[model samples]
Target: MTGASAGIGAAYAECLAARGFDLVLAARRTDRLEALAETLRNKFGVAVRAATADLADADQLEAFAAEIGADDTVTLLVNNAGTSTLAPVADTSVAAAQAMTDLNIRALVRLTMAVLPGMKDRDRGAIVNIGSVLGFRSLPVSTIYSATKAYVMLFTRGLIDELAGTNVSVQLVAPAATATDLWDISGVPLSALDPAIVMTVEAMVDAALAGLDAGETITMPSVEEADRLIADFDASTLALLGASQKSAPASRYLNVTA
Candidate 1:
């Protein structure tokens, strides 16, 4: 796990440790990572290594990627490290926005690339990407964050398509307002949101794991009818894609050629 220091990432670490998976926890905070590692080791009797690295830094990211590439024991990768700027595009700083993009998209892509070849060789592995419910809709304030998550969702789905028939599985976990520090980072207090919509981090991770076990490509924890919603969206998307392959432009665009 990339952001194994806190919040949902930390929760995932605890859950995975409880399940007897030895862990390699990575984060910028060496102190926190080491503390979590110690706790997991003592509690679960599983090997835990703390890797301190800022994934937004290319040098650090590649260093970690190289380590993962060389280590054949890695069977699962949870791409959970991400940042968000929950403000209007006009007000958000360019540097902060770029950092968010670097961590959320670029680093994720690079890490996935680093692990895939080896996973294919092993014929058994899984990649779980942390996405958000906002990925499916247009939401105010969370515009860029949602777009990045949308990329995550589409990216994982595309990987699922290519990895089919292999033992490798790619899963996108889209949690809906989970109880985490993300709201604090986004400048929204947890109390500001409706209590009914917020789910505990444990619940979210449990549902995501269940979805992974059930062979689902996309997992939306809060949605009661997720399967129906996914089926409907996939049908519509397939129709649109099929229609776009026509030989000629549609009548709607005939007179409006640019």
Candidate 2:
């Protein structure tokens, strides 16, 4: 698990540890990772490794991927390391944007690539990608972060399609405003969000795992009508696309003189 030091990542580690997954926790914070590893090892009696590496750093990311590729016991990968940008585009630092891109998109893609070949060879594996409910929306302050997560959701969905008929299961877990440090970095406090809307991290993880157990590729923990809505959206979109493929312009565009 990447970003297994805290927040949603930490929650996932705790849950997965209980589910009998020996863990390799990677993150930028060595102290936190080590502490978490110790706790899980002691409590769950599961083996745990703490890998300290900043995924935003290209060298660290490559090394981490290489290490994961070499580890044969790794049957599951939890890609949970991510950050949120709270600022508007004009106010956000270029460095922060670049770092987010590196961690959220570049590192994820690289790690997935590194793990996929082995998973395919073994014919048994699973990947849980952490995404956000905000990925489906155009939030004002979190535009780029939302875009990045949208990419995550779409990327996981693409993997689901590609890995079909293989034993590898790809899941996208999209949580809705869960109690995590994501709010702090996003310029919002968890306490400030409506209590009704924000779910506890444990609840979110449980729901996500439940979705996975039920064989869902996309899991939205907080959306009550998620499945129905997604089905409708997909059907409507396909119908729209089906109508757009034509040999000539529509009647609406035919009369245009320009």
Please give the distance, in angstroms, between residue 138's alpha carbon in candidate 1 and its true position after superposition.
2.6
Per-residue alpha-carbon lDDT of model 1 for 1-258, expressed as tens digits? 899999999999999999999999988999999999999999999999999999999999999999997889999999999888788888889987898888999889988998999999999899999888887774788888888888988898899999999999999999989888878887677889999989998899999998988988899988899999999999998999999998998989788868
1-258 in candidate 2: lDDT tens per residue? 999998888998999999889999999999999999999999999999999999989999999999999877789998989987777989889987887788888888889998999999999999989888877775788888888888897898899999999999999998888888878886777778888888888899899999999999999998889899889977997899999999998999887897
Each prediction's RMSD over C-alphas, in Å, is 1.5, 1.5
Q: How many residue pairs clash in each candidate?
A: 0, 0
Model 2's alpha-carbon lDDT is 0.89
lDDT, candidates in the order shown: 0.91, 0.89
For model 2, what is the error of residue 71's alpha carbon versus the real structure, in angstroms, after optimal superposition?
1.8
